[model samples]
Target: MSERVGAGKSGRKKVRDGIEGAKVVELRPKQGAASDKAEQDSEDRRFIHRDNGIWRRKGDNPPTFICGPVDVLAESRDEEGRNWGLLLAWDDRDGHRHEEAFPRALFAGDGNEIRSRLADGGLTLGAGTSAKAAFLEWLASLASEQRARSVTRIGWHAFGGQSAFVLPDETIGEAGERVVLQTTEREASLFGVSGTAEDWRREIGLMCAKNSRLVFAASCAFAAPLLGLLGEEGGGISFKGDSRVGKSTALRVAASVCGGTPQNGAGGYIRSWRSTSNGIESTALASCDALLPLDEMGQLDPREAGEIAYLLSNGQGKARSSRTGGARSVARFRILFLSTGELGLADLNREAGKATKAGQEVRFADLPADAGRGMGLFEYLHHEDTPEAFARYLRTATGQIYGAPLRIFLRRLADVMANEGEDELRGRLRDRIADLADDWLKDYPAASGQVRSVAARFAMVAVGGELATSYGLTGWADDTPSYMAGECFHAWLAERGTVGRREEEQAVQQLRDFIARNGEARFERWVDAVTAAEAQSEIPDAPPGERFRTQNRAGWKRWVREDDGKSAWRYLLTSEAMSEALSGLNQRSAKAVLVERGFLLPGKDGKIAAPISPPGHKKVRAYEVMAAILGSDEGDR
Candidate 1:
């Protein structure tokens, strides 16, 4: 069905069937990093130990050991065998030890990236050219000295098919292996265990006993890793309301489940929503295979807020060219984030004069922050005097025991995977998630497909909490996670105001609202036959107080005899006015929804506009709207 196109040095040329007249580019093995690795291996084999010390190199003015005793731990190679790096360990002036993987790409320029990172991590380099040169020279010397074997993964699990979950400084599912994060944005220092798992369980685990919001938050964090497992693209669950409703507290609690609290109440474990799209790409990668806790959605620029929502769902950042005109690797991540704010996605986009699409709303599911128990966002106070005090208590407790539960959960998960095998465990977990989703949706049989999709994410959260509980991490009752997930889901549904498609609901509501607001004021009054005859005869209006003129007519309305022999009002709208009422939506879809709901009647030809003529007016094609849409009781669809 399609012709093959070919491009050569000259220009693009259409190719018929065979390879004739098409330039064939011979593939070459990857060079640069790959060639360097082979050269390094050869140099290692021909090593002579000519330097005074292992850390000493030939480049320094006086051959010197730049830092403390150094060890070349491993040779790290990407999965393709074309790229490599070195794992180095050394001590600093404070006698503290540091270990990191130094990628060869950093040495392509002045090597400042490598030197600055070493210094930042406490491996001191001398100040002058000799000291800097000594440091760089010593680093190059490590290519020949082998300590261990290593593999590379650009971001999260299984770098180069080395199947271990790589965290900032630790590895899961693999013993005696460490994950050293050496990306441009250094985040290793932000991830660590601060307290005992026991303390965390006692301080935070019990707090979620009767609180659905807190439970949902914790579940969201745990559910992040499962996103990759379930093969589901990432999305977020937001808790939004007016300011000071314990929203930040919910985020803090969720953040603690993944890593330590922000140091001194500053950025660390909890990241703000104020980051640019580029900055967030790096941040999202840093939190890859885990939860990204974003606080205060209001901080993002309103114009970029909806764009940010789309960005998070994209799973990768913008691809930009490097200095040499080569394509740079885009930052990629798989994460489920938690967002909190005073405004929902819809409100935020509306503030920018944009109408949110149904897909975007599903991507960032918004739930009301308030639990409606008069306890702010809390369902239970846990013996605290007030919701504020309770929230404050949880926030403080999270800071104390942050970062332990997640480590425990990962360890347990690793063991389970090792025993049950990933395939078997994934199957069971998948079935469990589907079952949970079914439970969430069984009550709302008519929910939209978008609603069902979001329900699966909520179900994933429930699985995480319940799995952690089964491993004795969360100390909650068996049914707690599922119960909390359902509670929060129903709350979200209530806020959405419809079980059907969100856009459909909006379409119906928009027309109803427009007619209710402007029917009498904007529509021209039409006359009955008797009134028309009287007007034609130049007689005073037969009806005492009837008026037939409209100031700025959008359409026409007339009183007609009903089947019950009572007069009822019916409105007919012009095509232009109908378009205005259905602005910002798919006009065709809106009209279909209106027809299905009996809000708009179709002509015998099945078109949305019917051919009708009003008294004293020529016939025209117009949209006829039922008056019942303006009734006082048009509740949930």
Candidate 2:
């Protein structure tokens, strides 16, 4: 099949060329670092360049040949239709045939001229996008093929660097063992071999059956050796599985070997602000360069995922500080492994897809069979049968430090936090610690000591030393709080004569009594008490009819009558009275309230009740004219 390339942006062209009779080779890079390296390699493979470098298969055989790392260049026209500088190209390798047309057309710049303008840097690749997506997929496919051992053998060359030959375990036997084990250190797996004494599968199955812990340890050791294949700038691994399959343990071993922290050692970057005399300083990922073992990979917070994704894509450090301007250049690292449990296959697919897009290598570790069938994965890790064994394991792992900066440098790190002011820095640091706890650490102690070793490698210095170390502040020594507390709890159990004892009946009664008392009282109150408010208030006040004011044509005449030798009368009336009087008028007429309030007047037909304007036609404003003006002759009376 003709492999597609450059799905998103036209960053570069995808050239298809034959390697020993039309074998399609795809080169791509993960997110973060310059993916253009992948594009350059891809172009070199497509068209046969005499001086180009690539891994070529000889005579369609299983074995592959390591070719040169060649330069690729693209020719494009400027706005005015003039040919511009060579946009992108792979330079010719030494001791290879150089095609005149390919070099002349593509690499037109003088070697000296091109070399002079450069200050020891080449063109960088942009972020992961639709255009560069095809390259990402193709690279992932190639890695997957190697990981699955689909091809008989593959030669991998580090971009801008050296090359190595990778072959299946079937072809490479262990130096000392009667049988070889077929397994990847970069992956958490156990394969079964039926026949060959040189099969890696047989060795792994034996180690797992004798002690899965050894298998876990070996997996970590293997990953460490393969770190070089991960390369600089971009690339990482993700360990995925349920609790207690030794995911963290594997990476912890890797960290111990490499001398990096478990928490910050690998995976992504952690952003923090440091206080200095001038102001606050910030550090990202904190110079962590070791195996990262991320526990509970399933439940990461959105922000952490974003931070991890960013680092994986851009190879740029990210840090945000209020005291400082904003994001300062932070250090970036790769994910060594991610550990999780009880995640849906769908969720795993989504997460893996995202990691692949960001150029990350992720492996899903299944729960160990022996542990899985016995007492569940988590229970097996903490089983009391091997207390001394686990403790000793922890001591050995904690003694080793990885990726920790020198003491002198840490003071500067402290200063960065100090400049931000102790309180602010401490608060953020606490929050960061808390996030790691909720996201990864909660299920930690339940993980195997081997996995714990990996986690300890990537953890923060304070946390790793204080919590995970046997020689540090929170070690298993008699003086340490955790150790003392565990000892005290064990003692208390012994004092109660509860060692291997069953108190099920007493516990059941206690539970029943507590629930009957507290639970019933709460339920009664909730059921009996009113739960909603009344719709209306009960307070008494004036009726709407009595509080309303009346008016007439002269002005705002009150609804009062003058006793000037005549019956008491109203100059104006309340709406209720008006309606009642109109009903008793004894005449057929339609009653109309003024659209707006107005003074009473004679009739248009000139009848006394046929309202008409007063003679002078003196009209006050509508509201004023509507007044019920009542007058009296009290003096004459």
User: Best by TM-score, which number?
Assistant: 1
**Model 2's TM-score against the true structure:** 0.23
Q: Worst 10-residue stretch by lDDT in candidate 2? A: 526-535
Q: lDDT tens string, model 2, 136-168?
A: 232222321111112111222121122222221
Off by over 4 Å in 2: 1-218, 221-251, 260-289, 296-299, 303-310, 313-335, 338-637
| Cα lDDT, model 2, residue 174 | 17
Error of 1 at 413 (Å): 0.9
TM-score per candidate, in order?
0.80, 0.23
Candidate 1's TM-score: 0.80
Clashing pairs in 1: 73-148, 153-159
lDDT of 2 at 284: 15
Q: Please give the lDDT score for candidate 1.
A: 0.72
**How far out, in Å, is residue 350 in model 1?**
1.2
Model 2: residue 295 alpha-carbon error in angstroms: 3.5
